[model samples]
Target: MAQDADDAVDCGMTVGLYGRLRPYPWTGGEGGADDGGEELRERLVNLALSRAEAYDWYAPAGLRMRGGRSAHPVPDRWFLCDQGGADWTVGEDETGPARELLWMRADLPRRIASARLPLLPMTRTASDALHRAGDFRLAALRAHLPLHVTAGEADGDWEDMRDWFSLAAPAPTVTVRCAVAVSGEETTPPAWRSGGTAAEVGAVWQTLLGEAVTVAPGAPPATSAAGGGVRYRPYLEPARPVAAYRCRVREWTADAAVWLLETAGEALRRTGHRVPVELTAALA
Candidate 1:
């Protein structure tokens, strides 16, 4: 009985920490940026380190390997390729062949999850600039500006143009909690728990409500941009101006809320914005 209980605990611990470790995207060629490669690499490193700290903080006490060691061990010294070189190659030596030696522990997954990378702060100056740029973009859009105009043509003003671009923005995220009742007792039926999948839950709930229910995946939390702020090119067609413009705007605004939130959050992080626990809870 004791051995069975220990096995269960071990399984739980492994399940809890399995996906918590990951390599930084920039560690490989797939994560290279078009511009500002150096800056992006630095941010990626910082983000990885920050996520590591977060993982440690939120890590379960029982999360350990069979030998009571940490499931993910951090190295004493790490290496980051700062010479615009390819990914680090495995070698026997401590320095290996990597260019820059980062004298920090390598805990990539934790760092990525921690989101400890700094962002360009949205200062008074920067905020004013963004507002001005947004106004300019709005004017250009109204004037049927050509899509080729690359200056300040990004979709950063979705918040300011919510009313103008109502069709583009997605509906606010709504979390609903409910209990199933059978006669006087509340209980979930076997069908609902067959696979314990969201599809089953939705089907069961729709049957109970006697109406079709839309089951869409939740918008995942946004992450900071590796190179620059979240920017998307504008799609404009002057021939069918309203129809074409509206279609593009709708697509842009559909994901704007979440993207904007992430962009603002990253900026705030760079500016050292800290939220109080009580306030965060209240807002949530």
Candidate 2:
């Protein structure tokens, strides 16, 4: 179960504190059962909110990409990260009931006062209600997420994800900037991996990006088929594989990605790309 959630994490958001909760718990070698219904949903959601409160930051990359950001044609999976630790997969087989969960972030006081730092959860009914009938703050939190977009599924324990927002339609004559498929050895990173402060992650991301730009200073031969760009596969623990994020949110991820791709790859010897660059150092 935890392994499955790990796979989903690489589908979008890369490193940091991330988690996924199944409606019901799972038994050994068996899939998740929806033994609990709305009552269970309420329990799980409450757990998620508590978890969100513990983290100081939340990245909405996938929430926007899938929910409609054209640059990210391949929609990223739903995930929440606090910029420390590995992915948090909640289930009977994994971390049992959110109560017993151990996270990478330290329990500290809020650093940003008078700021909307917590990622609150909003019910589907509430979001669709007449005039979003609920706390006014929910409207503000909508920009970020934890948008309670849970839905029923036959495979309850599996990576059951639903859209948090309805995406807008794209123009008929639209142009795609890039398309990619990440294929490599995928595995769940240990809890101790990349357990650094958000600042540490930022510094590493920026430094590596600077070097990557120098390595591939020239542009690749133009291609309408859509190819070329650095890919980062973060190894949370020493030489351990943290899944590649399926998100293309741009900006926040750009520099961090370069760092994980080149520097982390060489150091860990665990990252690679579908497109070969040895023939040429690389191209921007």
Candidate 3:
């Protein structure tokens, strides 16, 4: 297994830890022009951009893979791409083979049940319907903004216009959590199979809720001409936005138990932006 140091070398780990590990820190305060959530978001954007530049696959194709890569360099653009579509499998029940669209560790169901988090069983088709309906309804609420784009291409100009943003009638927020024991084995859930074994599958949960933070034209501070904003707007399909709050691992073993939080103290201290709340939903 890769140690924390080794994992830190991976592209995903770096993107995920970007702003949260900076020296200046973002502690949610009032000071020079470099304090607050806007700065925090900008810091994250810069870090992500650097990583994206380093990795070739992380461009348009990687962005499109699995509905675009998470922790993208351009915050607004990544946000739009993610919020653009709810990609799902259609008519899989009758003809398509049983698929693992979004599989959680088997044990996760029980843990979440005990923790008392809301959950909804989702199929790919069902998730897509929710995504489509949600986007359509949200656009209608603010029809003046022209947020909706053509089927194939994105709404280029209006993509960064935050003035026309609106919330959904029924915003669904599904959070999934699962625990799996690590073993040195090849057989396990795909997510864990590569580096470790799934000794045990723990409880999992999924639910929907309303309330999210979105970027706007003037809301988030503007970027300098040095970093092109070409990547700061929605350029994908099925715009569905989801936020992440917290994701960590708790290891329980014979000798000791440990809880590893995924944030760097320096980053949070500098920006004053408490880590974002864990906000995520399944695409079914």
Candidate 4:
């Protein structure tokens, strides 16, 4: 989605968005006594440096935090940072949580993503999107470059990446459509309750394919450099990577895990448009 506001053509560059939001009664230091403001700021700075993928767009103006204090004058159109990575924007006041939008474009052109339109944030929600866009895979194939992909820290991605990069495989594409809903006061499945505690601004989803989805009930409210704060849900574990072509796209809710947006979008868009229906997701 690196195109200008009007152009939908994605020449294989990527734009990813991740969010960080905590309800009032905010308890800031989740990272023990060491989780002070300076340490947090350094983390965000280093993360932006890695995620920015360039010095030009970042060097001149550098990063800022929306509604967060500033030393010098804030840049006109700054890319801000937080626990969930960096975001590209006009630095609008956070409508909800502090979300970061990440853009990763390669030094050279690979292939135009077959998506007729530039992809959306929701389309690129899977964990892999955190590394690269699906279009880049196809672009590699079309450009005749060897396509190399990595799995997640967890096994989900390892299994997902087993597919052949080209469209000429026994089953070239795999997609997961998650129907996430707010768990509400209705007890989250016993397995999903956090030490019998529930979370706020919480989002939950079940595979539309009739599979079980469980949040990391006892995993505690975990904070990560990659994902702000997450309640793990082991949903995308692929039984076998080469099993299907038909994908039922996931539905998104406003309250869902903003970081998971990358995982969700990457999961669905991994299809590389080989299937009849090129699966996609939207913020709405």
Clash counts for all predictions: 9, 4, 45, 16
**Top candidate by TM-score:** 4
After superposition, candidate 1 runs with Cα above 4 Å error: 1-35, 55-201, 204-284
Superpose all Cα atoms of candidate 3 onto the true structure and report the RMSD in Å to 1 decimal: 23.7
* Candidate 1 lDDT by residue in tens digits, 1-284: 24332222111000000000112344442223344444444543454334434433332122335466334322211111111111222222323222211112111222122232111111111112222221111101001111111122223342333444344335543322111111111133332233323334334323222211122222211211111111211111111100000011123211222222222223222233222100000001
Candidates 2 and 4 compared: the better one by lDDT is 4
RMSD values, in order shown: 21.1, 21.3, 23.7, 18.5
Pitting candidate 1 against candidate 2, the one with the higher TM-score is 1
lDDT of 2 by residue, 1-284 (tens): 24322123222112111123332233121232233333333433344434434442333333333334222211222234332211123344553222211121111112111111121221221122211211111100001111112112222211111111112122222111211112233332232132432234334333333322212112222221122232222222123222211222222121222222333222121121211111111122
The superposed Cα distance between candidate 1 and the true structure at residue 203, in angstroms, equals 2.8
**What TM-score, computed on C-alpha atoms, does each candidate reach?**
0.19, 0.18, 0.19, 0.22
The whole-model C-alpha lDDT of candidate 1 against the native structure comes to: 0.22
Residue-wise C-alpha lDDT for candidate 3, range 176-247, written one tens digit per residue: 221111111222323233321111111111101102221111111121101111111221121222212222
* Model 3 ranges off by over 4 Å: 1-36, 60-284
Q: What is the lDDT of residue 252 in candidate 4?
A: 28
**70-125: candidate 4 lDDT, tens digit per residue:** 22213221222222323211123424333333222211112222222212222232
TM-score of model number 3: 0.19
